[model samples]
Target: MVTFAIGTDDFVVAGALPAISRDLAVSEGTTGQLVTVFSLAYAFSAPVMAVLTSRVPPRRLLGLGLTLFAALNFATALATSFEILLVLRIVTAVVAGTLSPAAFAIAGQRAEPGYAGRAIGVVAAGLTVSLAVGVPIGTWLSTRWGWHATFVAVGVFTVGALVTVAATLPRFEPVSEAGIGDRLRALRSPAILACAVTTTIGACAGLMPYIYVAPISEALTARPELLTVFIATIGVAGALGAAVGGHIADGWGPDRGMIATFGTALVVVLVWVGLHATVAPVPPVVIMGSLAVWGVAAWSNNAPMNARTLALAGPVGTEAMALNTSGLYVGMACGSAIGGLVLDRFGVTGTLLAAIGIGVCGVAAMVISVRRWPTGRPARGKAGKKARV
Candidate 1:
């Protein structure tokens, strides 16, 4: 529920941008900065906050973070000035950065033997579910009531998440009592660095085409309404993929799971490029089917990736997760920027080919990482001591 609320807060603003612009008397482009700042803040803050709060109990941190997050959303809904809202969004993002890594770390730590991947996947599914369900509902509320209503709704849901987390989550001590310097040093482990790099590269590859899905879809289909259906298909498939990916990691091991998921994603994207080349204006059903596969392959990789990072950075699991989160966001930003450049120079087809090339690099990075630390085992280092899952 916490992940769902945070994810909804992150993406829901896109749908409400026009209304927010009109109400706040700002350009839509300026209104869009809310999202850019949130992502940048989150990417930069996660690891730093994790280092600063390393000794805080997971349960306590989650509770406090969610409380602040809820309050921020409510305050954002009430803010009359865009400047205030932008600052509030940045603070809210910092809180979200704190909550998410702790949540994933706790889920992995508390899972029963051999079920860490499944547990993490369950938590990750919340984020995917938000993309599928929460954003749409929040968008509807914005259109029906007002843009501010969407923030109010997010706050309401976050309050529910806070209550559930406080009441149900077990109190766990910090995984490591290391000082900031020691925790930062743990991040230098080769295996940990490799995992982070793989995450960044894979995210960059997967998100490249995703950020430009609208234009890509337009080229494929004449009907505009089908774009909505295509997006819904991707979201639903992604949610399902999260669940299945966990089981794969547990049964096949994180290394194999990463390779399989990423390899499948590469193939799916290649198929998209091939279809576009061979058949201009491809059938809508074919596009939808391809998107479903792409979504599943792309989103399913999250679990094994998280599990891998946690295992490698055993003593500093939360810190590693935070770093992984940062890497994911960095890749997202880079992917969007690169995709825009490619789209401008080469069009949608060029964009797809560029994604494929980057994806190949991503897969190669994963392969090299797995070779270095086969079976997701941690490398020989202090950070790798007592590594789990």
Candidate 2:
């Protein structure tokens, strides 16, 4: 639920950008900066917070993070100026950054021997559902009551999440209690660095087309109002894909799972772009189906990615997830910026083509990372510590 609220807030802006721009007397392009600010804030904040709170109990940090998140959303709902809104968003994002990695780390800590991937996937499902369901509902609320109502709704959801988390989540100490040097060393490992690079690049590729989905939908359906449907299609597919990927990771290992997921995404985008560029104007049904496929292929890799990162980092799984989360946001910021530039210069088809190229680079990086450090292959390091998947 915490994730649901955070994810909803993270994505709802995409649907509300036009309304916000109109109300704030800013260009839609300027409104888009809200997302960029949040992403960049999160990219930088997660690691610092993870380290600062390394000794704090996971349950306590989770509670505080959600509380801050809800309060920030409420404050955002009341903001009357773009400057205030931007400041509120940046603070909210810094708080939001602390929640996800904590959730994944806790899930990994409590999960049964072989079920870590599934546990992480279950938590991640909240984010996927937000994309699928939350954004559309927020969009509807924005159109009806106003964009402010959407922020209030997210705040209300977070209240429920906070209650549930407090009542149900078990308190756990930090997994490693490793000092900064240890955490930094974990991040500096060849395999860990490679995986982080792959994750960032892959996420950037996956999100390139996603950031400009409204225009892409407008081009496909010729009815911008129907953009919600296309967005929902991606969300729905993402939810299912996360579920499937979890099981696949547990069975075949995260490496194989990510390779499959990323490879499939590459193909799906290639086909979608091909049809859009050379073939007939694709029908709404076909376009929606392609969006589903793209979402599924793109979003499925996160659980495995998290699991793999934890495995590679060994005892420093918490810190590693923090870094990985940072990478994810960095990719989001980059993808949004790249997508905006492409949209201005090349249009929707051009954005998709660029996504194809980025996806190829992402896949190549993943392949190299896996071959260099095979998933679940025990690596003997300091003091005979075995990095096991």
Candidate 3:
């Protein structure tokens, strides 16, 4: 739930960008800074927080992080200046970064030995759930009330998450055996680096259209509210896909499932573009159909990739997963930023073409890396089991 707050905190800002910009006397361009700053802080602080608190108790860290997150949400609600709001959002993410990794590490320690895939999927689902429930609901409420009210609501929920965690969350015993150097050593491995790149490319392709989905709907669809409908539908698809992906990761292995899924997602997005332009009044419904297919293809790979990294790093699984998780966000931030640039340089059609192109590049990177896999033989007979443990 704390992680859910973190995920929603970032996305809700996106949905309210138009409102925030107008109220704050800033450009819609500038309002996106809120999201950029938070993601930057999150990406930069996550690994460091994990390593620095390598010996700290998990429940303590989680509690501290959520408390700070709640405080930051209040700060955002009370912010009178854009500069202060920006700074606070960044600081909020720095503090909140501890939750995702710490929570996963804690969950892994508690999960049934063979149920690692299912356990981490639930943790990862917090991210999905944020998009599925938190962001959309927050956006609707923000539209009804003022944007400040949205922050206040989120702050209230953060307080609730903090309290629940304080009461029910179990204490985590930290293992401090690995030095910073050992964590650094894993990044030097070609296979690990390959996994990280796959994360980046995959997120890039996924986010290109996602960043501007609302705008696309406004431009292409007759009914504007249908934007929310498509987003809601896509959210449901992603959640279901993530669940299926977790199961496949536990069984078929990560690399094959993720790589194949990415390839399929490329097709879905391109098809969505055509459906939107040519399908006339029924575009939203068609797009929603495409989204359901895309969601499964896109999200199903998340858990498998994480599980794959756990297998890849062996004893260093926790650290690798932390970095990989951070890598995914880096991909999201960079992808959205690049997508914005593409939108600026070219129209929406051009943006669609660009997204399609990146999707292809991303797919190529995964295929080549998997086939040539820097330092391992592919699993025999198991067609989609290239993930090495």
Q: Against the true structure, candidate 3 has what lDDT? A: 0.70
Write the residue-wise lDDT of candidate 2 on 238-275 in tens digits.
89988887777777788889889888888887887777
Please report the candidate that would top TM-score against the real structure: 2
| lDDT values for all models | 0.79, 0.81, 0.70
* lDDT (tens digit, per residue) of candidate 3 on 212-311: 6766656566666665575666677877887787666666666677777777888877876776567644556666787788877887778767766665
TM-score of 3: 0.88
Give the alpha carbon lDDT tens digit for every residue of 182-226 in model 1: 789877878888888998888878876665665677676654445
Once fitted onto the true fold, the runs of candidate 2 whose alpha carbons sit more than 4 angstroms away are: 278-281, 377-389
Which is the better candidate, 2 or 3, if ranked by TM-score? 2
Among all candidates shown, the one with the greatest lDDT: 2
Could you tell me which residue pairs clash in candidate 1? none
Worst 10 residues of 1 by lDDT: 378-387
RMSD of each: 4.7, 4.1, 4.3
TM-score, candidate 1, is 0.85
